[model samples]
Target: MTIETETGSPEAPPKTRLHVDEPLAAGATVGLDHERAHYLRHVLRLDRGDRVALFNGRDGEWSARIDGFGKGWCSLAVDRQRRPQAPEPDLWLLFAPIKRTRIDFVAEKAAELGASVVWPVLTRHTDVARVNVDRLRANAIEAAEQCERLTVPDLREPAKLDQVTRDWSSDRTILLCAEAGPVKPIAAAVAGLKPGPVAILTGPEGGFAKDELDGLLKLPFVVPVGLGPRILRADTAALAALACWQALAGDWATGGADARPPFRSQEPG
Candidate 1:
């Protein structure tokens, strides 16, 4: 690690990632707003002509040079493609909201662990009844930028659990972290699934109501899975389930030129 100030706390220079909302191409010029300009200029202490990374989700990551700066904006000259646009695999996380911090945890971890979409659903036993979609979206963006992910997970409006279950896609498998009943080991369940779309369901700490559990279990596409003998917090269960699925059937299971993932989380907490 690079020394922060020799005598100061240890810190390396940040990766200099900026998520632009415009179409990016080689040799294109992109504008940065005041807030981002402030971040790059003051927070990151970047100077003119310094190199930075930029991505717009649709376009691939690019290495850019700070072209110029003004009162409220900064211009960047796109240099070259850093990483090609490769979206996360089709894995959706449908979770019930818990406490504020834990829900934030779910959003951050879901993006870091490769959730293509994050859907907040309201289950019968859920304690927290509301969600701040914008906050969740910001958390997703920060996580994506920090983790070097090409795209941020799509954040959806909160929906009722029953309605979500009713309109569920027939092609995608639903892996539910069950509150009770005969539960298949999560690892085994994920490992057995053929390559396809997936949606993992994790409810609030209070767990789903009897009727909700019963209805979900009855669905032909639903598969009740267990984490372990001990019950986990709502957020913990979601993380465990996501990691298990990725290792068994998702990108974590891919092998080619390199079995390692292209992205890495370099930002500190």
Candidate 2:
């Protein structure tokens, strides 16, 4: 079918979500590029007139319909807004890139945990010299879609750890996951920190070099913290620190400490 009318006059809107960079409003039209068009037409097998939700991270969520479509091209007619736009936490995950899959996991988890930015850092012990920022951004977008996040986290290009530290915003606190020196519990380290403009630094699997560690410790804005008595993998440390910050000082704590379960506990199928 080229176009589909709402079934029974009350068909449920499509659940597909796409992050666009344009302002969204009723009656506005949006064009899908070839890749996105392929996903809509061939991958999802959607016909003209099918509905799709759109979010630009600024104008909130909107319900849009496939008004026109063909091979590698599609246009959507914005219909109505659904959810209102909300501010994302200003937390940033600045970590040394690990293996390809593990670094990807860090990006996805960071997005899901509401990190406003994901930065790739190169440390003395970093094994990987470069990272695919596109892949990281795609992972962040997919995570945002799955988790009902209105916006995707900003992914940064790879840069040397030393330079990143030198240019970091001094007004923001940088929590460094260190195994040595005066270390506080991750929770205690983040205590009393507000939701805006904070970043966490996790090192590579081999840990930071002595010089690098000293450099970070000497940064006036850096706070060295430890996950626990036990050491965690780089990816694990990033996710754990994010969750700790959220539960301790981030938005997740707003549920009043006695909120419902973290997530549904149903057994896997």
Candidate 3:
């Protein structure tokens, strides 16, 4: 994708970035084709000679100057790599879909929160039976581009709980936010676990089924945890779990949360 920078004017233009599916390299003539060109030229009112930033999941972010635009084609001269790929944790978000909009929100937020992967789990009580992987991927790409994230979170295809859980590794602790009553708060559970690779799982609108919860609980690596006294929506629970994990064992504490340009996080307490 290519973006148009503002013309020579007194006002500072809004910062715009575009996500392209190609490797970005400094000092290269990057070309935009078809849909992206139209969006930049027509929708965004970007003209030839405008400046915009381009970033792919690899090669980081780069500055580019638009040379021309027309006939479903846009050209730009890549200047420099504006941002470098930063370190991101192995944190993953494994959640059951709630509804259309809510599920979309969860996918976008997971990308913004620095989750390396977003795994949509088909739980016993999950309401949504279908997921458009392409739609989720688009949402993630947009989120990463806007948020200046060099690395886009991988939105894995939705998998059944049993099938996915059976291959679980004991090395990575999986925190399942079971809505069941006895589970301890996530903060407490996280504090007790040895820090390394971590992932959080949130259930659907009706919560996890007893048999499903029982199976997950029986896993040696799965830690059944609670979010607090209040029951959260699937999306909210997923984001809250991410924040809590980042705060405790992730990167929110180190102030790395805002230090890196593309990704990475702050220190955890």
TM-score of 2: 0.88
Q: Cα deviation in Å at residue 171, candidate 1? A: 0.4
Once fitted onto the true fold, the runs of candidate 2 whose alpha carbons sit more than 4 angstroms away are 1-11, 192-196, 256-269
lDDT (Cα, tens digit) per residue for candidate 2, span 80-173: 7766787667888999999998988999999999899899999988999679999999999999876767899989898999899888879899
> Each candidate's TM vs. the true structure?
0.88, 0.88, 0.87
Residue lDDT tens for model 3, 75-101: 988766666766767899999877889
lDDT order, best first, reads 1, 2, 3
lDDT of each: 0.84, 0.84, 0.80
Off by over 4 Å in 3: 1-14, 257-269
Worst 10-residue lDDT window for candidate 2 reads 256-265
Better of 1 and 2 by lDDT: 1
Better of 2 and 3 by lDDT: 2
Residue 166 accuracy (lDDT) in model 1? 86
